[model samples]
Target: MKIEDWFQTLRSKAETIEEKWSDATEQERLQLADQLFYLRQVSDTVVDLWLQFEERLSIAIRRIKQMEGQLPVDDKHTQVAVTNETSDKDSSQSEVASAPLKKGKESTSELKEANPYDPVFRRGEGFYHLRMFQDAKKCFEELMQHAPDWESGRLYYAYSLLFCEEQEHAFREFRLLSRSASSPTVVASSFNAIGCILAEEQQWLEAAQAFKSSLEIKTDQEEARYNLALCYLKDGDAQEALDEIEKCLQKDEDDWESQMLWLRAAQLLQSMDESAELAPPSPIQLPTRDLDTDTLQEMASLYESVGNYHRAQICYHFLTERLPREGWAWHGLAWNTWLIAGTKRALTLMKKAISLAPDQDDFTFSYGWMQLFDGKIDEAVRAFRQMLEKNRENRLGQSGMISAYEKMGEYAAAKRMAKEFTEDQEPYVRSLGYFHLGRLAVVEENWRMAEQYFQRTLPHISQLREVPIYMQLCASKLGEQTSVKELLQPEL
Candidate 1:
């Protein structure tokens, strides 16, 4: 029986046992008492089972949200690889200029089938949105099996496997996609995926070449542009990175990710310039305690920018103590303090922050994150669950749920929740999920799978720039011999 159904049966047994006690003889009463005790025990057991299932489902749901956030938003570009013959038969032929148009009948047939209100291709999109790769993979695989050569199904299946860290399989699929597609967008997206894979292997030069090829196929694809810039930066070509990012900004100004890349490129260029000049350094200007909170925060950020966690903490501590309810301040302070000290102090401060501003999702998330870091998995789950209840769309809450589930060694629950919360398929979320799965696989001595997960995770390094260097150090313990260089390529 299902867990809930079993629980109901036990509850009914307990009710019957209680009801039978009213008109019993002494011997019958004694018998009824024993029966009642057994029923109570059964009830407790069933209740425990229900709680366990509920907890697992809750954790799974949270992870699903987190994973969904990791998926790319360019759903328009997420197509399955199909033969040219298929394209010729479909209306995508007119949409993609390279495909030779069939006579009027094919176009008419496509138009007749096209229902603006219908979402025929959205069967597993919810799973895809949630970052439930295996579930999404299953859905897409079934779709392809049922409707062979459906481009969207094939693409989504490959995309799901990308999260599963099946690098070779995903890469092969993309290669086939690139070879067969008439659409420049499809070709560009395929090349981009391949470039990202190469980057995971730390083949920076090759990655750059692949990204360039993708851009050649479709110059307007911003992700490819940003990734190519990252490749340039990795190769110590700051000027190229800077120039490329500048051009990218021309196409989309509000792309904060590209802006951050531009910032990194600019910083690298400045470093290169400084190295060339051989000039004496200027004397440092120390700030007094009377400095404004904004200035202090700025100083802290600058220290953080340079990887100076100790100095950053000092600044954050001062700022957060003064502005106790500032959620971001508390978050900054907790992360830096965790690095400088250990998770203990970070936990304390995060708790204080949460108490000071009980409703702030960011502070709640930080507290949960610190708890997870401290190995307080149950506490982390509570904090994340509360955060999610407050706002189902909380990214940090979703990420924290994934972390908590992983810490508790519930891999299936973790994978399920990661997808549910990360609905957008942001690269960072994908990276984080892959990172956890990689670590888990390594622990299980599944080295090949670990290596593939790590490779899939490489494109997300830039998203994790703020993550402690030590986490990477720990993850690098996988027995696989993949180059670290390949895994640091920026995927934006």
Candidate 2:
């Protein structure tokens, strides 16, 4: 059957089910709900696939735009022989495909080279976007055979697999990406996908954990948060479920899904309360206007420390209302914005913070990260450099510069910066330098060297989560017999 025919058939089936619903038996309606749920899941999964693929699509489109009029009369697509030698041949294909992976966007003129796989990707992506998952699966299978390492192709493949009901295969692909993808966005998306698969299997605890992990990697993903809330409800944590729903509502008060979840959570809580004889908590005065500035700041900082960014944001918002030009309040608010809304809006908020207090190293560093995640690598680098120039004692600035250098593929320059950091008088600063040096070594596939760097810094910076993570990653790569759980966390 043609892709259109099958898609239309599914639509026809849904229409028939809806038409019969008015007179259907309870059991029949349940069956219909199952079918509708499947369709809804497929739609949600494919939309996520397209969101991940959109970056590749935009890059491919830009490159094609730059290479206009240079195409051959016959733009024939051929399946290149898959082999170890393909790495060498990638240079002759799309320049974008061959470039070292980074989060930031590359300029089109810098990489306009064509590849046969680009055409295949466009075709697959087109089918994938149209809800023709079966045809999309075939196209992505071919793309995978051609370029197995491309995360975007793998994402589409996994998404199509889920729609095809190949749940096990989809889970494996998503799990792999979550564990090893270089980009945080890709890793977070993979974790969210894993959560969905686990949730479908009725493994509510595992699914909730996956969603939490996704949020830990990138807190601003609303879909993951919603899934986490649903999982909490399923896991019988009514109050926790309500908290997650409230966070979603904070983003969009009118969000129908969040409102529904909130209602469900409240009902669950009420049912539990009716059954249990719990004592009522003591009440306190609400929303006093006489709170001092320092008290408000402390409250915001305390909430921020506990991952209660919404509450922190509320306090910061109140502070901003009272102290319109205060950079500290704006800076705190900007960080929460990053956690709750992501880089697009956070970047603008951070710029306001930076402009108000050009002298605060904390604000400057925060602005640089906001810029970096927003894909403005050069601007982020400048912010980091400027902060370092203003005060050479600022270790965060040095670390930021090292990170930006690695993103830009300037390993030698990054190494130089790392070395300078190691020479810092402060042990904490030196630990950061060694930590970044370890990261650079890992990037170059020098597992043993990376392990040594990690070990040297572990005592000083083990408090920072990434130190143990890299140490475990290096240990695993060096053939050490260690539980891989420690790769993501220091413990189980």
CA deviation > 4 Å runs, candidate 2:
1-292, 389-394, 481-492
What shift in Å separates residue 68 of candidate 1 from its native position after superposition? Answer: 80
Query: 1-492 in candidate 1: lDDT tens per residue?
Result: 896897688678777777877877899988888887887687556545644565466446535644787323332333222332222223211211111111111000011112221132343544554445677677767766665455555666666677677989989888887788666766777787777777767688987887888889878766677778887877789889877877877775644445545545555554444222221112223334676686677667655654557766877878877887676787788888888888877877777767767877877777777677777888889989998887887777877877777777787877676555334567677677676666666566676666666666655555444222323444566433433343343446
RMSD, candidate 1, Å = 23.6
Instruction: Specify the highest-lDDT model's number.
Output: 2
- Model 1 TM-score is 0.40
> Per-residue lDDT of 200-281 in model 2, one digit per residue for the tens?
6678899889998989998986767877888888777988987787887778654544554555565556444422222211
For candidate 1, the lDDT comes to: 0.62
Off by over 4 Å in 1: 1-282, 321-327, 419-425, 465-482, 489-492
**How many clashing residue pairs, candidate 2?**
0
Alpha-carbon local distance difference test for all models: 0.62, 0.70
